[model samples]
Target: MTGCQGELVGQEVSLYIEDNEGNVIKDEIVTTQDNGFIDLWLPRDHLYRVTIKQGDLSAESEISTFEGDNTCITDMQLL
Candidate 1:
């Protein structure tokens, strides 16, 4: 599995993980580090969607499906 990260300096972004039934399982407000990056972890046997927002700039990652313990990294660029 592969995931992505977003880059936003001194800005607050929201992260959410949803199940296949469109129910929110986890959500949080994350601030990017000095490098403008954040790490995320998702559970197995579930589908997830990730979104990053900073001010008027926001981007969403494609729906990702996980089946086992694995690590995925993705990068989102705020426009």
Candidate 2:
């Protein structure tokens, strides 16, 4: 959430998430918390593609909920 850390807190963004199998998990607007972060709870042991957009900026990344995957995702960036 690099480009989203400070003033972007409480901002609403479009969130789109889908599983590797092409199942849509989430497709809606979400607000960042006080910490300028959005938390998503998905099923475990699966791979997912996530996209977040705020106005003209957007970020997309692949994530996994496997056992050894890092819970804290900090790589997705809005540019």
Q: Judging by TM-score against the true structure, name the best candidate.
A: 2
- What lDDT would each prediction earn against the true structure? 0.65, 0.90
lDDT of 2 by residue, 1-79 (tens): 3444644688999999999999999999999899788889989999999999998999999999999999888778788
**Candidate 2: which pairs clash?**
none
Tens-place lDDT per residue, model 1, 5-40, is 444555678776667688887688887767567766
- Displacement of residue 64 (Cα, Å) in model 1 is 2.9
Q: Residue 52 in candidate 2 has what lDDT?
A: 94
Model 2 TM: 0.89
Local lDDT at 36 for model 1: 61
Ten contiguous residues with the weakest lDDT in model 1:
65-74
Off by over 4 Å in 2: 1-7
What candidate 1 gets wrong by more than 4 Å, as runs, is 1-7, 63-70
